[model samples]
Target chain A: MFYREAGEFKTSYVDDNQTFPIRFDRYRYYFVLFAAFLVIPFAVNDYWVNAVFMPFLIYSIAAIGLNILVGYCGQVSLGTGGFMAVGAYACYKLMTAMPEVNIFFHVLMAGGITAMVGMAFGLPSLRIKGFYLAVATLAAQFFLVWLFNKVPWFYNYSASGQISAPERTVFGIAVTGANTSAWASYMFCLVFVFICGILARNLTRGTQGRKWMAIRDMDIAAEIIGVDPLKSKLSAFAVSSFFIGVSGALFFSVYLGAVEVGEAFGITKSFLVLFMVIIGGLGSIFGSFAGAAFLVLLPVLLKNVLVGMLGWPTDLAAHLEFMIVGAMIIIFLIAEPHGLAQLWRVAKEKLRLWPFPH
Target chain B: MSNEEGYVTADGRKIGGTLMEMKNITLRFGGVKAITDISFDIKEGEIRAIIGPNGAGKSSMLNVISGFYVPQEGEVWFKGAKRPQMRPYQVAQQGIARTFQNIALFEGMSVLDNVMTGRLNYMKSNILHQAMWKGKAEKEEVENREAVEKIIDFLEIQSIRKTPVARLPYGLKKRVELARALAAEPMLLLLDEPMAGMNVEEKEDMSRFILDVNDEFGTTIALIEHDMGVVMDLSDRVVVMDYGKKIGDGTPDEVRSNQDVIDAYLGVSHD
Candidate 1:
């Protein structure tokens, strides 16, 4: 009943070109949003929202961002962690320098600054491509994290080599740092994720999205077909950076409260995000969300179910989680390169017919 | 504005309005020369073919015209003005479009979306409009679909509109690529070896589509073809290249008669 489209007629051509053809899909999206905003907070306790769900939402946003550049645009980048660091650092700087500025604006500005940095790294993509270009982005990750750590100004001349969020609020609700409540933080991040998800969807669905995909599909043919690789590739970097930067800002300010430069947004973090996108689906917008959610929730759920409940050692549980994730990536690549998004689609298809799947 | 923009030439031969002109292009890749002082003109509303053996830089020529590879020497003039050193998108903005030799249809995309991407230049709405799926973006999508549908009809690819490009046959994929190119409504159309890998029936179908595109749209076509018969039949004039140099230029019959072209095709042995 949750996915039934009995009578929805598409009268106009505009209606026919929708991302979702069925009316059930539209309502389902609305229902999910409703549950996320309303039902989710009440259903789970504060610890669950803060420790698990909030971080997952935030990671999804960053995964979606990296996916735009790496997946959709066909640009290989290992600097997502660096860009995320830029976001977090930028937010810190903005909040300190302009105390009166809205936390929302500061978060957005962080993303904007990250976009500029992402573009700078993306310049090398024009000269180099494939694995060679990927190596160039790895340089971005190393150099940026190193620079941020050394630069005292980025950390506000903190005595310790770590930056922590200050008191930040939105509409009288604590939304950042240690003082923030679990529900408020989750809601804030969830809202940001919602807006950014919609933004990513729009961007990838339009001329910009088509341009990136065309380049990803085939650069030479893309050129003949009138796609400017320079503009498209850079735009991918900019938009992707914006999402990641914002996510990083949230990861520190809302979720983590405090983060050391090398610790939080390191190369491992970059790989984690990349893995999320890869396992979700390459060259798919929805795949970014599916991947982020699957990867984020799986380990936590696994550790809890396998270790916490079954009384296994934490090390063994962690190892099992890693192996499962690794094996799934390989299987997905060989069996269904589209990842969990494809799985979700298949599930939806079966749901459409219910008893009669033939 | 293009180099030939608003210019008129009342010549004895047919002045179909110079849509695109590659002026004395000299392209070199380090030690090897790709195109050596080659010059060609495409008249508006004419089907001009570039014929050459392998390694004659036929693809290189198309690349230069499409702004993929910049020529070392010479200017590309379009519609009566000196064209800027434009990107591929800029070239498209100047009302030029192209198809690839290997059927460059976006493999994972549906035939409809692949063709729709050709109208990317014309889709005016911004990200905000697209996000809301609101007024301008919706209207633009509708307009784009209408235009693409016309191209689909022209290519007779009605059934495979929703089918992914990867699943389509080689002939259908090539036609879809053409459909995608034609969707742009380009003033200058470039097709690189459109019938190179096609069977006899597929070649005939592609030829018919090409003729219809030129006739119906008044599009100026500059094609590189291997099949001599298709080149002779479809094109008004042929520019033959040998060793990156223009060996013969004129009507197909004239190029066919030229002894240099004959020698280039059938290697001339020194006495």
Candidate 2:
């Protein structure tokens, strides 16, 4: 009875129409923000922050980008890692080419560069859809990854064709390379992610997002109802790629520090982001973050607990992580096809009705 | 209405003018003809019905008119403008909207959202205002929602406004689909079997709504249906087609007794 959503007074239309009208929900959201921005950073050790939380957040952002294209727009892609590679390489190129440019703008411009490349791959989507569309994207993923590996210019003319990060500053504050502190990196990531999150939320709620959903739901019906499928679909790709590209840039600059194409961003990395989206919630935006965190942290936590603390073999811990993650993926899919986002929603719902059977 | 086919308006509302003109519409799939030289006109604020036996290209004609299919030979004119072969969206933008034979709603989205999707083109809210949830975009949203709510009220779907379209019953889903088409506020509406799978009560309810839609919104309606009784009561004029050819075109009473129309349906098997 105490947990019910009833009697939540919404005096004005503005109050009534807020995304989360329930008082408890709004409070809970603030609690999460506090924990993420204030409490957790203070409490968590540098090891956890550097090795797990930071990577997870970056990957979550990338997963959010992929979910927009694949889950929301109904266009499956296998080129997330290729876009990431573009972002990483672009970031590297920007830093070296323009010594006087700020690191923050460089990272963002890197995101924009990836966006252009992602759009190029996304162009094939106009002629094809479904499985064929996925295959078409595969061409971009493979070709881009190969280009970064083979082209010396992408690697800044290095002999090994691998670009390494040079320590850089944003407004005289350290952001890139080993000299940069974890707090600066984390704060930078947090701020950018928040902005991107807000932008994405707004985009999905408005007319452009509706057009994409219409195309996703039923293209023929969408067309008959006055939604231009071609332009709308392309816009979905553009917006989706823009976000994913930015996430990729952030994942490289802030998190990885130094990057190589084949090792850091590749086909395997694409699967990593896809798994995050699948495990989080297919179309749910928050689910992308949740899925990314779950996937990113599971292995690290397993390694630490099973190997570091328990003195078990690294391979055994690795195998166990795989087994557990695989099993959870199956369980999550069977139990709730909507993913961890749905699970989180269910938990919140149950919490809302605690101590009441009805 | 037209001088050639006199349309008597209900309640003396002069909501009449030819909105869509189809001339010599021929659709062919390989050697088999789906529609052969069928010409028809739909007048503004009038319910025009196309009735025929199975495979007589009634739905095919609707599809052609709505730009789902490009007729091999014909001219489609809308609002006194010559219609080129446009995509379905182009037709929709030209003040034409349509519902499908099979209900195609976004199962995941709420009824309100589904209907709001129909007004996507009209609601020109960009990303910036949406991000801030203020200014022009938010204003446009409220305006569009008001229009959608009116349609929702008109269709008596206020209770199920926030329910997912998939959770709705067959009859309600059909109505929600209609609400969505209405949300577009089109001058012409094409309905492919509006009351296809309804019970007697639902059919009557739907018929009343259809009539109200014509009188209230003054939308030009072209529907393909099989139910003879409803067609006779609802349509100002009925066009009869067989094997894609217009066998008879006149007031319902004239076409109901036409020997050629009767022979097309009863004369032979799948003729």
Top DockQ hit: 2
In TM-score terms, candidate 2 sits at 0.95
Docking level for model 2: medium
For model 1, what share of native contacts is present? 0.61
Give the per-residue lDDT digits (tens) of candidate 2, residues A217-278: 78778788888777777777777777777777777777877677788887898888888998
Q: For candidate 1, what is the DockQ-based docking class?
A: medium
The regions of model 2 sitting more than 4 angstroms off are: A1-3, A9-17, A348-358, B1-7, B127-133, B268-271
Chain A vs. true chain A, TM-score per model, equals 0.94, 0.93
Over the stretch B1-271, how does candidate 2's per-residue lDDT look in tens digits?
Answer: 3564445664465645677889998999999999998888877777889998899998888888888889899899887789887988888888788888999888877898899988876887666676666677777887788888899999999999878788889999999999999999988888889999899999999999998998888888888888889998998878998878899998788887999998887785664
lDDT of 1 by residue, B130-238 (tens): 7676678777888888888888887889999889789988888888888888898998899999998889999998898898887788788999999999998888778
- Give the count of colliding residue pairs in each prediction: 10, 0
Residue A109 lDDT (model 2)? 88
Poorest lDDT segment (10 consecutive residues) of candidate 2 chain A: A10-19
lDDT of each: 0.86, 0.82
